[model samples]
Target: MNKKGYSRSFISLWIGEIVSEFGGAAGGIVNGLLLYEITGSKEWMGALWLIYFLPSLALQGISSPFLNHVIKEKMLKNIQLIRSGAYLLPLLGYLSGEDYITIIGLIILQCLLGLVQPIYASLSFSLLPDLCTEKELVQANSLLDGTLRLMSFIAPGITSLLLIFSPIYVIYIISSLMFLLSYISLLQIPQNSVEKIATWSKKFWWEELKAGYFTFFQYPHLLKLTILSSIVQFAVGATMVINVPFIRGELNGQAWEYAVFSVTFPVGYAIGMLLLTKLPKNNLLMYSGLIGGGLSFVLLYFVPTLPLAWACELIGGILFPLFNAQSAAYFQREAPRERLSQLSSIRLLFLRLTMPLGILFASVSFLGINTRLTYLLIGTFIVLPGLYFLIKTIINRDSSAKHIRNIV
Candidate 1:
């Protein structure tokens, strides 16, 4: 696709992503609050998080062949319908006041989300070839990231304010509307003539599935990136899972403080997105790990006050997106388009699997140690393996530079 042609689709998807992210953020906050109200147990709240993640672990390999086999348009339409239904189910439960069934229904809804997300992920990358130049991919992804961060800035606060009046049904209405909009936007995308692989015999499906796993091994750079990303994901999940409890218990803060901290990360992320045009993209992984990871930990350690903690989060937010944007661009640049979806699915599986472990470990550490010490321990210990990979990748690249120059 030409630059002019790509712009039209890019603009549409960009708008869709923005709306969807805002609605997702709002719905997430409301759902958590409602669940807590219904169950009156932190365990259930944690379980909700776990349920949201478990599908990723289970579906990674299974989804890949299906992703490759299905038509992108058909896949997207089915996904939208599934997601819309998932959104509506909770509203029904909310109105009925059947707490037990509602909890079960909500778990089912999250499971549906887990199924649909990889399809969306695959489609999103597929669209890039139609919607962007190779050179524009980084900026395009940055725009998407920035939009999400901006939505994060507003959604929680808006949802909290709305919760003051009515929480449950409001979120349902909002989620439904957002999904509706997303479906419409997806419909606007022009279907591409994708080359389909010949139907494999029954034996081929198994081979294709195994191929997805082996593909990562064949691409060492991508393999390393995947491992590094999973590590970062684990760290992030641990922080998020513990953050609410930390603010509530250790700091003796209110819900508003939690809202503020949540908002801070996005604010910093917005700032980071703006800075991407000015910075070199090559060293993003290493720089983000050293700066964002280190600063986040330091803030958790020394910043006892809410205001100061927010400041640290803002700084960390600014640096973190650099890491994410560059990593995504790296995958897009290096991976074959036909296999991108499978690779992404596998990557997500590792990430989701490790993230819970990290959160579990962090939670256990918090049981015996002080919260600040737990933060320090995770920052120092858990995050190091990923950082080590990033450092190694950077050094290897530097070492290769001189050899390439000599060859030139």
Candidate 2:
């Protein structure tokens, strides 16, 4: 364990995660840029994402049972290595100077990334409890979450700078190197940090898969958290689809203004990570974060100016980490240790499934909902439930207080 009370393994994992996230973010941006540069078709871009998301979600659904059967640390390292090689495909195609080959490479790369990400994420999440003491898990989660968000925030700017001096394909090489570095960082973790479950059968695989979902539903608190997280993801998906139109069209904002609006949330998220360490970790803070973030979305519906829109995103960014990191820690702590990997995969499947739903909700204009109204609807979806839970929490506390007073 380190001086901060985290195991060296955890620190290594954190470092690896940070590097990989930066690479992923930078590569994601360049993927779109390079694809658009080659094909110049919005439909193809959308199709490319579909190729990634459809298979990724499918794999996430069926892959949970396998997680509990594997060594998480090794799996994570292997994923990073695969990602490193996957990133090189586009660069290789570009070197060959064939647009079709480059496109094919990008498609293949996305497919590979899509398949591995769910497994990687599930393994890393399950490994977290092993990487730190129970007392240190929240802070560990916060640190990991914060730095990853920071990397996402930083990658775009750095990628843009790189683009100014080199071909776009060069970014892919850098991304590949980043993943290789991540793999090396992960290698420093002790091999025994995770133990694979010793059981295997075709029948057992089916049973474990069913058990993952069954066990998840058997825990109401975990289910509730997953649902809430899913709703947030749904809102996020909608925001992705509508933010451009609402900012540039409705608000008549410039490109720079829109960029600022896009960035404020992650910036606030980094700040929120710091703020969480100073605040008490409790249901109140967690629920309040959810409600506050929801309110930010609601406020976007009312904002008359571009700055207010930016403020809304910034406020949401600042508040969301409060709920996210704590809830994640809570889930990790509450989950049965042996089944945690399977359960983590189950939890992630639900979360991943919601984003595309939100995107569809926003994108389908036949619903006849305007952009602001969609914002209002998404915010309300979050806020009303949040308010319900918050009120229930307060009432429960009061009832307990009265009972205590009577007993005294």
Candidate 3:
């Protein structure tokens, strides 16, 4: 495609994702609050987090092959509508004055909504290469990253403010609206504009899945990237699952403080994305991981006050997106287009599974230790190796650095 053509498609996709992210952030805050309200127990709140993730871990693995075979654009549209409906489902239960049992049921429904996400992510990335040339991929990914951060920064505050006048249902209503609007924007995208295989061996499914896994392992560098990504994702998940309790109990703050803290990370993330737009895409992965690893420790150990925490979070926000954008761009560039979806699915499966696993580990550890101490220990411990590996990766790939410089 020409630059203009790519720009148009990138803008369309970016708008859809931004709208969807806004809805997602709103729904997340409201769901957690409602779950806490209904159950009135931190354990159950933790369980709610687990429930939201477990299904995606199981379903993404089980459905990977089938998801790989689907028509990418069509599947994305369907997924958006499914997500839109899922956002609306909680409203019915809220309106009906359902009890704890209903809340549990809604939690399960939310899990199912999450099950579609890996497939959605896979399709979205696959579309990017088709929509834009290789030279444009980095810039396009930065745009998507910025949109995500923007939504993350704004959505929670809006959701929390809405809660002041009304019950959590306001969040659900707004989330539903944003999701539907996202779906409408998605509809503007043309279907099956990218190339597809005409036919494959009946064994292709099994072979392809195996090949994806095998390819990931065969490329040691990529495998290392995936593992590091998983670790960082786990660290992120642990922090997020505990953030509400940490704010409310540890900091003696309200929901609004939680919103403020939430907004800070994305503010940092937007900064990172903006930086990526201007910086050369060289040693991006290594540098981003190093920054992220360092920031994680700072945010965990030294952010004694809300203001300081916000500062650390802003730094984390910046580094995390840089790591993700660079890693994703690298994978997209290196992976074979024919098997990209399957490869993407497997990578996502690891990322999803690691999150709940991290949360579980963190939750269990929290049972025995002070939350702050736990954060400090885990943050410092996990980050060091991550930083070491990231630096090693960059040094090992000196030629890749030279290639990156040439691109710039």
Q: lDDT scores for all predictions?
A: 0.73, 0.90, 0.74
lDDT per residue, candidate 1, 36-84, as tens digits? 8888999988788777666655666476766665567556656766776
Q: State TM-scores per candidate.
A: 0.85, 0.95, 0.81
Question: Which candidate number would show the highest TM-score if scored against the true structure?
Answer: 2
Best by lDDT: 2
Residue pairs clashing in model 1 are: none
In angstroms, the error of model 2 at 123 is 0.8
Candidate 2 lDDT (Cα, 0 to 1): 0.90
Error in Å for residue 393 of model 2? 1.0
Candidate rank order under lDDT: 2, 3, 1
Model 1 ranges off by over 4 Å: 1-6, 32-51, 93-107, 165-167, 193-202, 245-255, 284-291, 381-408
**Candidate 3: clashing pairs of residues:** 268-318
Task: Please give the ranking of all candidate structures by TM-score, highest first, separated by commas.
Answer: 2, 1, 3
